[model samples]
Target: MNSFSKLRFRQSIFAKFTFSFIIVGLIPLLALSYISLNTFSNYLERYAVTNFEQMLLFASKNVDDLYTRYNNESKLMYSYGTNKGQILGETIAAQTLEGDYRLTRTVDDFLQTVLYTDRHLQSVFFVFPNGAYQTVTKQNRTFDFRYQFPDREWGEVLQQNRNLLSYFPTHLDNYYLGSNQQVLTFGRNLLNVVNAPGVEGEIVGSLYMDVSMGAFDEIFQQMMLNSKDVVYVLDQNNRILYSSDRASIGQTYVQKDSNEYYRMQKDNANVAWKIVGELYKDELVMRTRKIINTIAIVVGLCIVSLILVAIWFSRRFSKPIRSITREMAKVESGNFDTQVTVQTADELGLLSRGFNKMVVRLQSYIEEVYVAQIKQKHAELNALKNQIRPHYLYNTLEVIRMSAVANDDNEVGDMILSLSHQLKYVLDYGQETVALQEEKTNIEQYFRLMELRYGEHKLSMDFRFEGDVLSCSLPKLSIQPIVENAIYHGIMPKSGKGTIRITAEELADNLLCVTVDDDGVGMTEETLHQVRQKLESSYSLDSGGSSIGLKNVHDRIVTLYGPDYGLEINSTKHIGTSVRMVIPLGEVNASAERHNS
Candidate 1:
């Protein structure tokens, strides 16, 4: 039964290979062909839509520019009152008997001479609030002089209506050689008398543009021939005012009084005007079908040719490829012992040889990494020992000091307790800095112990803490070594009791200030200056007695805080000595400091 199962499994390989090959090959071919078709279609569709939006903006800008030009001209005309910026300033004595025709004639003379010759302009008109009007046609034709006021001339449209700007029904059948023309009429209300007071103010003119749809249609036709796109022109309300396809013009592009995005406008509302462009969906669909057909033909022929070559090479390629794949599988599974055994003299053989060498190198690297990890663990263990053992010693000493207290040796016990407290403060904060208050306390405790040991050694302590200064932190051993320097060099060498006064205060502008003053056997001017200069500058603490005397405090401050915060010294010979420090002030929150760092 076992041998029968082995025979059946061997047959299953051929069946699996046929099924897997069909699936892998066909799925990619079909999906890739579809993607190619859709990609081209989408690109063209988006390209046309983008072009349409740009065209919309361009047309809107043109209208705005034209309106601004006309408005500026009226401003120049209004300035005629005092000839502030006018070419010809005139004052009329009478309002009515001065004659409406006279003012119309004056404006007409300028329009005919300056405006009628311009190419883009179609017409210019002057409208009086009395409903009398005059116009000059820019078109290349002649007509009756009285026909210049086309009855629907802007003044007559607002004869009884007081709208600032209005669009009214008008006949163009008798004008323009009896041809029907759709016109977009824009108007501005002008005063009849420049700077007139109250009801005396009259409509001067309605400067308007009656845009012929034929001009835009011509431009649209040219565009449609060159690029398969549609463009729509919109008014301030985003209503479709014009379209490349004449049929879509005058239709509502977006619904009115609708809140839904799809039901509302897609573009901005404050815009003076807009142009919207898009390609036809049928054009995109047609292109997609062409793309799919082209891909289908190309892929079918490619597969037919590749399959013929694949059949011939399949048996020949399988042996080496299968061997390489198996070797890579071992590498993936982290079995570096498996070596590729192919003996070809081509690039494939070179790759196999390189891979084998890489596996050997990887094995060596793994072994070295294991050894390094063991060494790292050993170093970490030693560092932890260094950090914890000092604290244990301090705790033991504290226990001894308490025991002495129980034995009723008050003087001995108190001295022991001071030393023990100082030791614990130092050891418990071995790798950390302590507050300025704690540093002073530790220094005082050390002083008590020293004084206890030497009965004749008398010293007076004068320490004062000002507001917000005592809370500032300093290195744990900062004050201790300085105190030791005084005891050894200055205080001890002196003949009588010495005074050690330490003061901590905050400067008015938020700075930490520490001063340690000692009236012991102070050095001469030259020596004191040298000490100050040396402590201010940087040098190694492992240098000399100078280093032990001052560099310890300097290095600790600079290393923990920064260079700006190192020790500063000032002194006068035999008068006294002071060591000062200014460090960045912060309450030590252990976790926050570590996280920020």
Candidate 2:
């Protein structure tokens, strides 16, 4: 390995931080991006499957509806006479007029009446067992000698399967000379309907209705030609009932081998036919590829940028500490007066100050070793207290700064009083705890400042307390961070007016629960999961910009109470979010402990 690689391999803080930061940061980001893409792909596929199935179902229903109309027409024709045998008893030979057989005329008129009644019926025919037949078309009428049906196979099949409705494929019938056209046939047995006691009725003849295929041609064409999806309607025998590829019609589909395809089926009960839709996956993914690729590229660039930033910051931080190390090395060699100077007000500056104090302390230790322990303890306690006071003071001054900016434009002095009340509450740290009512008042003043800053009507709040739960004491500012998160991160980002509802209730075993619910653009599941994970673990301000406020609130609650008490986040996308705070109901301090004991 090169010298640089060897140096990075060592357990140096700079190399470890840089490497760990990049690995810890980029892995989850990349993994999450990959998972999200796959999730979206699955979602799209499911959506497409639903839409295709619905369309196929609709097409099947349409075909069924058409078939039902014709089926019902056949039933209507069978019920032509009031008596069961009235219509079927009339024989063609019996219709004699003026000593000339008027059988041809009587049969022709009967068939023509049926053809003309329904526009879809192209032709009609009836054939009896007595070697006589009559047929009628929309444009012509014909009487024929018993020639038997042209499709003799189907004819024999129909006779064998008597009294049942049967469907026929597209075919040319030469029964009429001038009226030969392609038509779909629906035929059934015409039997004597009369019920005579102890007598069996005989079959009179067979009735056939030839429907023009042109009626359904338009429907099938519209379904296929308008969309890129492929559709196929199949019969019970798996024959192509209708297809976008007209040539494929009448061909059987035996589950052809193909990948990246989805199939959906529907049954047209009226016709006893099945409809199948074969949708190709390529057609679906083509439209979504651009979006997926864009997201992948963006995520990749983000990871690269994060890695570069980690490297730059790690180097920047290590350089100053290396300088401090060298100065400490000089002090190790009996240079008690040595001091390191750092101007910036950061950890490095604090380290330099400590280093300076340590050098002075070591020099004093040589002269007064007996008092060193006492002096060091006192100095450490005073230093910690001093550090805490400034941080609290800085937060108070920030609120005052915001209030002062608003005070310049308003004539009313209510803003100043609210800021004063907030300032006084922070400065008066004589007690580490406060009454529940005083904390509520402090929250009210903070809300007033927020209202003036954002203007009225942008946000609203409703507070509810169940049975004196508000009387219980809580740490000062425990609820303020939660309320602030609801406004800034939750409600403020929404498009419409937002409402936040805060409710306090007393639970069993001296536990108090406060919940804040907001009407806002709620978090996505991934975001909610991330936030919950942060709340359950150690809270860090450096996690992200938006989660900082929530983490602070959760950490404070958990720190004051036990691990069982903290904040819980529940959210649904586009609906809203609810944050519940659980804590013990009392002041959290030594004095409260003493009083209870």
Candidate 3:
């Protein structure tokens, strides 16, 4: 039955290996496939939008360049008559009704030169302040002589702001008779150039140039990648100046449905116009579908292949592991002689060999080290028992003595009882740590004995413990020795009554600081220096005067906690002495609990 149980355990391990391997391989593959599909679609959409934005930027740049060219040509026309000894502004300023025909011929010839330079120019008109105008057109079209300049909106804008250039959105060429071509117009007030310095010139007339929509058509057609894609050129008010849909021209461009298309716009820097492009979403989906399908098929194949490989690998991997497991079971059942056969030089075989070596060493350790430690512990306990016997005998004798003395002097009897208690505490070798309250009780008894031995008024003891500090743990006899030093060396040498203040408080960084301060005579600087040096030295064997007890307490504290914790002595000659001991609260408590256990 045991063998069958072991066999079932090994089979369960094999099954677990296969299942874990499948899960580990399958989850990431499925996640990657899902991520790849979504990532490819997002990437395609982003790529299309970026291309559309770049195309609109190029179209806007082209439109800006076209506007700049026409602006420069208009300036050239304004300053053309300079070579004729007078500018066009001056000629228009000097116009009269009788000489208007000759002025018209000259202005028409100058404007014709600019009209023929670009085939997109529809017409150029120079309208004088008196409401008369000279016009030229690409086609030899007649002009509307009845049209008045000062009454028109664009004309009035130029007349009011003599230095302003005005631009108009697409409208029918109404200045030319029987003409219906859609054209964008530019109107600028022509200023007479003043030869004298710091003199402002007055407006002579206004120059108006009209450009056909065919100029923007060429730009849009070159950038369009699909027939469904639409482009619009909009003025500052969002009204369409030109669009792929001719009917939408001159109307406010409403935003297209975002779900069906990707839209981008670029603003022209030279003009208050923007180029907008809308690309169909169907094109982006069509481009990403093929990549997504390919990824799906590849991921499916990888998952299928991973399952077959996992099953085969788990079977091979479990055989050697089963042999090791059976040997481990034997070891668990107290058969340390058991060994596993290493069939290969791989890591599993190394594990089998290491297992056999570990068992040999464990058996050797139990025989050689473990048994010897137990024997040593027994011997030490016997020694401690032997030492406790003498103390027990001494305490019994002292108790007999105290009982006999109690019949006469009760004070002396009580002091004898306190001495017995102190001896018991000092002699007990079992506990290395005691609580603050226990140590405090021991100190109170010692002071009681001192008070009874000497006059009660000679030495006054005060203990101040802050907030549960009496429950904190410290090494046994840690404070008692220092109190003994203060009494003998500090208080006894003083002339009058002396005070010993013992305070225990929790300091920062999990430290417990206990200060034994006395108003007795303090040491001189040189003697205090020597005493501090003795306390700091680890190997100092100076059993000199009162420092003996101080050094012992300091050494014990330093040994238990690290070197960072120890006694610090501050003294002034003929004034007082204070000895401060800082110890780690956590380590002392832990040590006390460990020793008790």
Clashes of each: 6, 0, 0
What's the TM-score of every candidate structure?
0.38, 0.45, 0.43
Say what the RMSD of model 3 is: 22.1
Candidate 3: deviation at residue 427, Å?
84
> Sort by lDDT, best first: what order?
3, 2, 1
Clashes of 2: 0
Instruction: Give the per-residue Cα lDDT of candidate 3 at 172.
Output: 83
- Badly placed stretches (over 4 Å) of model 3 are 1-35, 95-101, 144-151, 174-178, 195-200, 225-228, 257-263, 279-283, 290-597
Could you give candidate 3's per-residue lDDT for residues 1-597 as a string of tens digits?
Answer: 699987776568788899899999989988888897798778877877787788788888998998888878778755677345876667655664346656777777778887887888888888776666777787689877765542478876676756656778788877568888888888887776654245357766778889889988888777757767889998889999999888888899999899998888888898888888888888767767776778788888989999999998888788888888888898888888977876654445446666776666555556777777567556655654565575666668587767868678778777777877787667644457788887898999899999888787799999999988877888899998888888898889999888999999999989899999999889999999999998988655564655988899989988888888899999998888999999987433543543332
Worst 10 contiguous positions by lDDT, candidate 3: 588-597
lDDT of 2 by residue, 1-597 (tens): 999879756767788879888999988998899899999877877887787777777778888887887777665445554222345323432333233355566556667777777887887877765635567766654634444563566667567766667777755556665555666788766655555343234566666888876666655654542244567766677776566766666677766446857767787777768877777777778656767888889998999899999999888777768778888898888777677866443445555676677677767766776678568747865775664564566567566656766768342345665776676666543344555666678878878888777767788888888886555777677777778888888888898778888888888898888888988888999999988888777645775767677787777777777778888899988788999988888744554332222
**Local lDDT at 107 for model 2:** 56
The lDDT of model 1 is 0.60
Indicate which candidate wins on TM-score: 2
lDDT of 1 at 317: 43
> In model 2, where do residues sit more than 4 Å from their true spots?
1-15, 31-69, 81-158, 172-183, 192-207, 211-239, 252-255, 258-302, 308-597
Clashing pairs in 2: none
C-alpha lDDT of all candidate models, in order: 0.60, 0.70, 0.79
TM-score of 3: 0.43
Q: Model 3 misses residue 390 by how many Å?
A: 82
